[model samples]
Target: MAPNNQTLGNNELGAWRIFSLFMLLIQKGPLPSAEIYAAIYSDLSTDSALRTFSRDRTVLKQLGFAITEVKTGKEKSFYLSDSNFFNSSYDLSPEDANQLLVICSAILTDATFVYQEELRNALSKIVGNFYSLESGKSDSQKLSASSQNKVFPVLYESLSSKQLVNITYTNSQDLVKQKHLGVLDFFVSQRLLYFVAQDFSSGTESASIKTFRVDRVLDAAILKNESFSIPEEFDSKDYKLLDFQLGLQADTLTAFVPKNILAAFEHFSQGQGDVELLSNGALWTVTYAHEDTALSWILAHGLIPRSPESLLAKWKGSLSEVANGC
Candidate 1:
């Protein structure tokens, strides 16, 4: 009825007329039939244009446009009230909702969860729709999903209950050892859960919480009798130097990385530093640690970190040359 090409002189109402009327109401908000047709119907000058558009509304209703009236007035107006995009029952802020979507996307890269595709698709659709509402904002986060099923509860409950656990763990130096450890805290770092522990090799002794990879733990048994105190003075975040224990005599050293790599570097170092950007664009500095974990971390990140060339690299390079048959 509203001057659309498909509606002029047609005995039966066309689908395009109904679709255009619905889109007009959605985009421009509610309007009465006279205003709606005057805005869109080219046949408004014709004799039967009003009756034709009224029939079009009936066609739209049959096609599922749950259009509702705004008020009981001389001029009746209508709008879409049942649209999925306009619904407000979903509970999530635009940003966190999108973040949850990204988490779903990144997890799909893992082959371990392929069998649960139906559940994954449902979550994906929900999150994808949620993300669509917050499109064009940059809040990107990348994380790898664990191959194992839920492990946080085991670690969290063990630490909260003050239980001692026996586990086979590999330290930063790749040295695997089996020992009884008292749980101090459970935390997620870089998307992996770590259990902070104290060595229970001897008597009831208080020690700094040394982090153990939760995934690598071969076995966990709760020892009900043992208990220990985490020093009030000890700060979990700043004690990287003071708290480290590799079963080796504690000592100090310096490590550095380029400023761009400083974020990964901070994971292994204390807060203090006077690092200088060298002419070659690498960082040079000092740190203190009892074990080679700090160095190994840098190497693992492929950041090419080095101790003083005179102390560590000269011998390392010599070994490299000999291994190369030079």
Candidate 2:
């Protein structure tokens, strides 16, 4: 057992040594093989180290490191061709570093931001390396756990591992229910976190794919043994909470938006619409699922539907009913 443990330790060290060699070559490159072996393995005989390095070169190439070799006379020089490895050489100027420090300071001090502690810690580490930045001070007005939704990390893990989870969810109507979900993807919109997932339990009258507000989740338990895969056709980009519909089919909505609401609409649509600025407002054409939620948004915003006679007639009927009730 002792010998086996020692072997395992040696294997781990060997792997790290190989990675270090890659990083060294990436930082200071086009070096001859003799020089690389001398820098990394001074303890080994020159001939033996050269042979081992030559074999490791093939291993690095197979791992997609983009190692390039250039021949000069009887010697071969090697370097990493990936631009990302060389980005560290481009150091930020003092002015740029100061600007980053200011921005990070502002964000770190703001308690309203989501993941505020995590963001502040990350920024502190980065800024600390360049300039002396003060540690984050505790705020008296820190957000409560309920408002922060502590379930974010659990949902993130479920989504990453493709695991199924049992969730106690509070619906829009304030009804509480339990559900088994195969986590798919997550996104934030309108300062709210939402998950796009597949319902695995029975009595799902709607589409199998649906979205759930993370904040409304009262409890979640990950099912480690139960794993699921997302459908090949499902794309998270096609679905958005702002669109007000979860259905896969969509129809083009043409309307004139007021100048005040144009920016809000653009934020929700994520620049997925065609807009032409007019003297009074903007003429916009965007795609949305033909659902009650979509119709309600158009009515709420007092938008005039420019196409689809059925939709126009429905909108008129809705207004008539509202006026009659009043």
Candidate 3:
């Protein structure tokens, strides 16, 4: 229904359309077809847009991306109920068996199950944090050791009380050492447990924030009566610090993708950025966390950089290096 010519390839335009549909649902949450039609199919007449929407929806359903339509008083609205992104299968480790033992010890130590309320309230928080919900065939997270298990409860306590702690941590090289830290928070990413803390072992004046995987901690002792303050400007958001999002400089990049190869770019964009579908190609605008990140995407997708001379130079240099290698 929408215009598709050799000027811009079908894949690019098609992918953008699909990605836009998904993002439309994400940004606005529940959206009725009328709103979607206006946003995506405004160029088409009502009849044409309806036909196009039906075809796209059918294809998406076939792909197993469940976009559910709920009946809302004579009108239907779409909603994305869930995603399997974090519902991953993890195999239980020996450390998990170790945790099972610790759990049993805890429950047995508690004499009065009375209402089971107090026991439930206490163990729930610690167990839920690192529980292997279901053991599966995949070996995603193997255990380093359960020694960190001893330290975690102390870390959790300090985090709640704003108390400082002294800990001995073992690195990948097996080098073990002790340091004082102020635990800020704990988070799970990709099924592993990690805590963010400020290292103040040297002194409160030279404290530095860092993320430590829970399993690496060898020992912990809560420093009672000792506490620390987080820096006022410390924003939790700026610290997701996932590898791709971390870089030396942040730049909003402009990329021109050929008509045919647009799908790849669209897929990468996930409709989180701006896109201008032109007769010849698609102009995509997004911010890259670093020059290397920009170069990686552009080189992989064969995109032409239209702005940011620095990125263009880096692209050229990469191409030159590749040519020399060949």
Candidate 4:
């Protein structure tokens, strides 16, 4: 055997076999331990192996295997108990697999974060394993699309080490803005990475840090500029994604969503805000953070404003003006 594969005692062999069987049980869902042992180690019949098998059973139970004891006073046995293990399929779903592929594509194309190469390799390994399983499947049925996996693993390491980065970045408005941006901190929520960028231009009084979505980044390069410490005042723990107000300038926007729109209140009151249900039963009083994305989303629904002819007429006129402009 190779150096990696040393001679195994009967007990070690039993433990290894049991571990493999446990993974199969998780994939196949809810099997009595006895059934699992029989399925994987039916050929093994030795005293030491049986003793090792008993110990492995206890170890597996402690490792969150959802194993529970089943007893009817006279008979007792252990069985797999978790129901969630059956969810999301033994393999990745078509939709979720596709979503990961898209994310990989975006990461490849994005030029912001400096950790793409390393993370992309890791992500690709996961994706490659998935595709390798579908060897005989048709090309159309497989995830064969190519993306660059545009993450800057090198730049990411620099940020992680508290080193400074220099890059020309455009502001949110899509202008040709260039400046050295210091990466203060990095955090992720809901699978989106946020880079806290601080302006590092001279002649500017002070630097102000702002969050940028990693996916939208154009490019990043590590600068030889002096390194800076992240401010203690900045606490990402208290930060919430919806708290940042972007776009539309409105204290409140009154709109109507059809009853069929699922979880309208949950969608509207994402951040810290109050949503009041109007008395008329048709409209919802939504007090939001006056964000552009939220407003555009609400406007995109093309909800008709309610009652009081003047308000309705104003909205109609606004719509007509926007339509003519478009």
Candidate 5:
């Protein structure tokens, strides 16, 4: 077994599977599922391996990895950075590179959903070391300060102290609204920094959490008069993904899953969707903001998709591309 997959458990709940997948995808090129399964789950059969791989892929999606499918007629092959985004030289431009820098800065300070602060710090320095070959040390300093979101430090302090905050936020529609939030998770996705919080100022029951884009925040002031704490019963991880789907202009997607893989599919789509029992098989409806993401997952898993003409067209387009390539 590879060193990466050795210690991770054999089940879907083993989060290390995600790191394992990363290690696999970061290798010498696009790899088919058969090879990936062989490398990560050498002891398990293909059916058994897909169960865990599906869950790991779900985690990757949550973390904003754009896993692309490159294939011929034989099998689907996954290539992590199709746009060469991973190999691009370090720059100060306010684009994807800048977004990565912003994320690195936040992970170095805030409590995270997956990686630890120390781990993230190590990754930042490692990437910095790589970038040093081209640029100098001063560029690295610029990298840290490049997180131009002015409200970031206050949000970090708010989470650290369990303090409440009043934020004037602009939604996707560009309508600005005021919210008093208990800052929970501050992280980045698809090149934007977002935070999940309990909205104390909402008119609804306020039982559910909400995600907000930090850059969209017009102003943020920590409410010194109020403090908040998460109850022992509340699990932020469970709600974070679903709220993120809602936070974006996410669309609903329904698909059919074979009985053989239904359990794994259900587990994989956790936090963002649900399953319906049917006489024939099972149906899964997922809320996602990115079309490429949905297409990649569907291709990677070999699931039968039913809705959202855009996705189906893209899925067919993927197959047609492969066919044309052959």
Candidate 6:
């Protein structure tokens, strides 16, 4: 049993050696089986070496190496098909490259972000690969400065440390109010950053979740003495901003969307619709809470509502009003 175990270990070591040798040889150029066997295992007999090489070739293919066999006259040689396999390079389109540069420039120019230095260093490495140092620096300097959100850093810190925060916020109606909140998460929407928090002003046990626009916050201070735990069942996705209207009841609405504006409709709906393809267009069924948003989307995209007679009539009436105005 000891001798058998030693033999198995030796076999495994030999298998790894063959695999490495095969990879090295194929990367340099195609080599015939005889040449590969001779180069890898000089001590073994040609027949034995050839058998091992053949087995290892199968293993290499299974491991996702793009090794292809080519027949030059009578001899077969194996070579890697993908030339850039060992040193892969990203091939971004011109537009995508420009966009990436723009975003990196924005991040580098913005001094308010907490991770500014780290982010700049990382982005410099990536952008440096494509653009010259002088060009990258020039672009960064030319980029527009970010709109300052004074409370953003404070909210970020509170969210990270699981601490309570007291904020003085101005509502849309220009009324100022102060509240204590338990931070849950943060997200960006429509170029504005918002925080999802639990309202502690209503008391702890019956606290309700709410979203606060960071830009509207007049002042924010972290409460170091108090900390809060996030609910085990809470998911950030469930608290994302939906549309302009809040707390409105959602109704299932169906529309026949023309092919030309289908993409626009999908973008407005945020991919929340069931779609069926037609020869000329697509039929979409969506659940929307905001009537004004839905109405504007329908008018803009020339969408035809298919169900809920009341909605269809409303759309027609709106179109009629527009027609009269024209």
Cα RMSD (angstroms) for every candidate in the order listed: 19.7, 16.4, 17.0, 14.7, 15.8, 15.5
Superposed model 1: Cα runs more than 4 Å off: 1-152, 168-178, 186-193, 238-284, 288-307, 310-326
Model 1 agreement with the true structure over 53-79: per-residue lDDT tens digits = 667766556544556767647777776
TM-score, predicted candidate 5 vs. hidden true structure: 0.45
| TM-scores for candidates 1 onward, in order | 0.35, 0.41, 0.39, 0.39, 0.45, 0.46
lDDT by residue for model 6 (36-138), tens: 6666666678787777667776665554455677997788887776753432334434444444444433333233333444443443343333332222234
In terms of TM-score, the best-performing candidate is 6
> The CA-based lDDT of model 2 is what?
0.62
Per-residue lDDT tens digits for candidate 2, residues 213-264, read 6656767778889877778899877555564544354677777788778767
**lDDT, candidates in the order shown:** 0.50, 0.62, 0.62, 0.50, 0.61, 0.61
The candidate, 4 or 6, that scores higher on TM-score is 6
Tens-place lDDT per residue, model 5, 1-326, is 32323342343225344555675676546888778877677767778787867767665655556577777578988768756434324333325444444444433333423344334444434433223222322443222332323355566556756788888776768687888888777544444445778888864544457777665565677999688877567775555463225445557788888888777876656545677888777887878776677777777776777888888888778888999995
Stretches off by above 4 angstroms in model 3 are: 1-146, 204-206, 243-326
Clashes of each: 6, 0, 5, 14, 0, 0
User: Please, what's the RMSD in Å of model 5?
Assistant: 15.8
Tell me the lDDT of candidate 6: 0.61
The segments of candidate 6 whose C-alpha lies over 4 angstroms from its true place after superposition are 1-148, 247-268, 271-290, 301-303, 306-311, 321-325
Weakest 10 consecutive residues, lDDT, candidate 5? 128-137
Q: How far is candidate 3 from the true structure (C-alpha RMSD, Å)?
A: 17.0
Q: After superposition, how far is residue 247 of candidate 2 from its true place, in Å?
A: 9.6
Name the regions of candidate 2 deviating beyond 4 angstroms. Answer: 1-149, 203-207, 243-252, 256-268, 271-326
lDDT of 3 by residue, 40-153 (tens): 888789898888777777655554455777888887888765762112344345465344333333332233213223333333343433433322214443332344345656
Q: How close is candidate 6 to the true structure, as a TM-score?
A: 0.46
- Ranked by TM-score, the better of candidates 1 and 6 is 6
lDDT of 4 by residue, 1-326 (tens): 11134565655454445545555554554455456557665665656446756677666554434455566355455556765323333455445444554444433433443344555455444443444333333554322323212333423534554555655444546564555666654444333445566666663636776676444444555666466676778764333344324323345555665655525545543433334544433465543444444445555654555533445566677688889995
**Candidate 5 global lDDT:** 0.61
Rank order by TM-score, top first? 6, 5, 2, 3, 4, 1
